[model samples]
Target: MRKTMLPVFTVIFFALGWALFSLSNTTVSQIQPRTLTLATTTSTVDSGLLDRLNPVFEEKFNAQVHMLSLGTGAALRTAENGDADVVLVHARSAEDAFIEAGFGINRRDVMFNDFIVVGPSNDPANIHNLESASEAFTRIAQTQSLFVSRGDQSGTHQKEQVVWATANINPQGNWHLSVGQGMGNTLLQSSELGAYTISDRGTWLALKDRLNLEVLIEGPVKGGDLILLNPYGVIAVNPAHHSDRDYELAMAYIGFLTSIEAQQMIDDFRIDDEPLFFADALNEQPNFEQYVPQSR
Candidate 1:
């Protein structure tokens, strides 16, 4: 009986050892890289900034960054729905509204590139060199010169709406073409139609060589107009709202964006010796309360 018991115990020990080894192998094999999802505007993707920036973060952290390039409104909605970990967008009013609704937290200013109006080289609307974007829109409408509108609720579209509102012109007609497209497509369409459209300077600079369109109205950065000042912000989706959201990773991403290294990368990113985005993360201390919506 003792001999039989010894063999049984040996078999049991071997089985347990094999089981533990198998479990260890399974765990090691199943290890996956951390993934962080970011929803941002198309302008960022179009300007190729992410292409230049994302790889550095991924390699340093051993994580993968999945980016969804949508319109600013759509990107915010994506984060609100818990589909994205964070957002990088330019529309301050919308970003404030999102935070006010409790869908986001830890909002930080990232970078900025002003918006510009571009049109045909011939300058049919005679809006070239205009100091006011509103006045430029007014001329386009008055002449009924074809104007391409993004129509989609993008940040660029929101700025366009503001300019139209400031001009006090209810633009509607065959001449006002609302394409409901992304910035790159809108610029292409504007070029195809020889029409006027508003574009972010970064994208305009990146893709200008491909399109027939030329910058006709500069934003404040180039001393064109104050209303065209376009600032961008990065916001992490509130983990309180969505417990599954990778809030820690999102904050890390935001940290990397505002870090000295990333900010310098943004400053150094250029097209044809012209910096597309001005780094404001370190230098600017904007009124935070101004962007945060007050409870009524």
Candidate 2:
């Protein structure tokens, strides 16, 4: 009876020690910072800019960044639903709408990259050397050339619509293909179909090697074409809408992104020695109020 009792006591002591160890570990884990959810556009993720920048943010803050890469519209929707802590998108009009709707706050300019019309190397629509994007779109529609549209309502898609409106052409027919996909997929589709599509310069440069398309129109060609200026902004999801949002972490991320170090990193990001995104946080911030609709 004494020996049996001795073994039982030893087992109970070990079990109690194990339970205390687990409890302590759980307490530590619970006290540790949680992950940050960032809903951003696909261009940033697909172009590998986030991959290059997120690690520094994570390390500095001791928190993991869970990226929900989607179109600017979808990303804003996610933030509106209180599913994301922050967002990085490019469509100025849409961003203005979001801010006015009270879904986001602290909008800041992060970077700028122009949009370009890319198509087959042969230039079927004879759009090559065309200074105006609207003229190029008109030509594409007039010729009924295969033109791919990212019907996903992404930032790129929004810009495409603006160009179409500028051209005064409601593109339709079999020639205008609305693929309802992201920039990378749309670009791939365009390449496969040998069609024309609009793409941000950064994504194009990053994925150009794998694609057969060539840039049909680019900016600074001795004429003013500000229509292609694609600027990216970072906005924190309003915590008032979602009580669980990690507002502090989101602001930390914003600071990290807008910091001088991160700005330099943005300027340094390149593909094949050519810079991808130009740093704009240090420069003049865009007056998005002008883009805001009067109805708001």
Candidate 3:
């Protein structure tokens, strides 16, 4: 009888242990925060916009937002590879291409800040007060002034390429420096070299105090260069293409960004009295076709 009792006791103890372990696991699972991955441009991160914005979203949703800040091209590629749940970037043509390629969906215009040509205070290219970015590029090339390019396929880099193309000059030679770096580093390099470079206004406002560079050509907001208008978009990775992603959360994030509260936050966010980004989601009517691929 005693041996039988001992066996029963051992069985009960094992069962109890298993039950507790299961309960513990269930509790952990219930308490675990849902994580959403965001692949975005360095400008957003560098300008401290995300620092102000992400925390609000994270707290509101009780979720964790893991950010992968890179150049716009790299950010899009990250989503293309299914590593990110969503993307926030400024390159419209590339964003259109991503949607057309079926890697992303439901792209919504989120914000706008124009690109500015920044260079030494001396304005070696004599590009100061230029109303056209293309003309500025032409001057830079013609003078063979040191031009620092992001070269990393960032939105700023894409804009620079367009300007160079507009100027009809294939930039090369020692005067043209292609630094495959982020916006901040590229600006720092440009400052160090006293070379002219294009940067988004947000980043320029955020970092101009620390650098010796000054805005040579302002974007449309402050100047007449409409080509420098930089608009940002947010898109979710196509859930059908990658089912493992947090599509619901991605959409929720997009909703939050476009929401009135968030838009106000974007509008109110500034650095030293200079607004970093202007919220555009509410100001413009949604182009239904722009949300999806044109073919669809």
Candidate 4:
């Protein structure tokens, strides 16, 4: 009886050892590399573009994506600090500055969508039907109509400053409200106050259903007027700045973004059957200088 019990104990010990070894191997095999950090604008997150595209990237590369959604300015800053692996942002001037400062590398055009001035349907400032954003802004300033500004130093905010500068009006007063928030929040503030605000067409379209705001300036597409072309670019954080930077994964994301399939997905992204962003990866580089205001 003692001999039989000894063999049984030995078999049980061997079985437990085998089970532990298999479990250890499985855990090691399941362990993936560090998550790819993508710092991007709220517009992309708010519009659900990232949600649709990121999963495809993860599946293709066998990687995990950790998205940091912020204003473009904050996104760039995050990349600059080496806290992010890559950045997807608008504001070409800011992008150029980031690359010039050596915080980013291999910048590539990803996509574009124009900005629009959205306001109450009643059009308190009567900026509706205006061909020029500068002219519309001038009217808003003159009327002292309620205007909500993102004022968050985001790409949208930077573009808004350019519009104001073009109009040659220094916006100040009770009517001009500066909320240091994101595009979505700013739009909600504008809607709540029945004020006017500039917004990326994508976010505007996505949120328009629930808001009382109407597109006062329908960008170049509807032909009302301003060439408020908002182009987006993706840049990998320079590995020189951060030793742990996932440069390979960053390039993979860039490649995926510029691929024909991804570009088609961008073109297909729409709200209420209206396309949000136009694919530009296959298009020639646009003359961004023309969009920049010349110094007076």
Which 10 consecutive residues of model 3 have the lowest summed lDDT?
A: 287-296
lDDT of 3 by residue, 121-200 (tens): 99888998778889999999999999999888989999899888988999999999998988888899999999999999
Candidate 1 off by > 4 Å: 1-31, 284-291, 294-296
Better of 1 and 4 by lDDT: 1
Per-structure clash totals for the candidates:
0, 0, 0, 0
Q: Write the per-residue lDDT of candidate 1 for residues 168-196, one digit (tens) a residue.
A: 99999999999999888888888888989
> Which residue segments of model 4 deviate by more than 4 Å?
1-34, 224-226, 284-296
Model 2 lowest lDDT segment of ten: 285-294
Tens-digit lDDT track of model 4 for 166-253 = 8999999999999999888898889899999999988888788789898888787566555587888898999999879899999999
> Across residues 1-296, which tens digit of lDDT does each residue of candidate 2 receive?
45568779889999999999998788457657669999999889988999999989987988889999999999999999999999999888899899998888888888888899899999889999788999999999998999999998899999999999999999989999999988888999999999999998878887898999998888532233679888888999889988799989999998999899999999998888888888777646555543344365
Please, what is the whole-model Cα lDDT of each candidate in the order they appear? Answer: 0.89, 0.88, 0.89, 0.87
TM accuracy, model 3: 0.86
List per-candidate RMSD values in Å: 10.1, 7.4, 8.3, 8.3
The CA lDDT at 12 in model 2 is 97
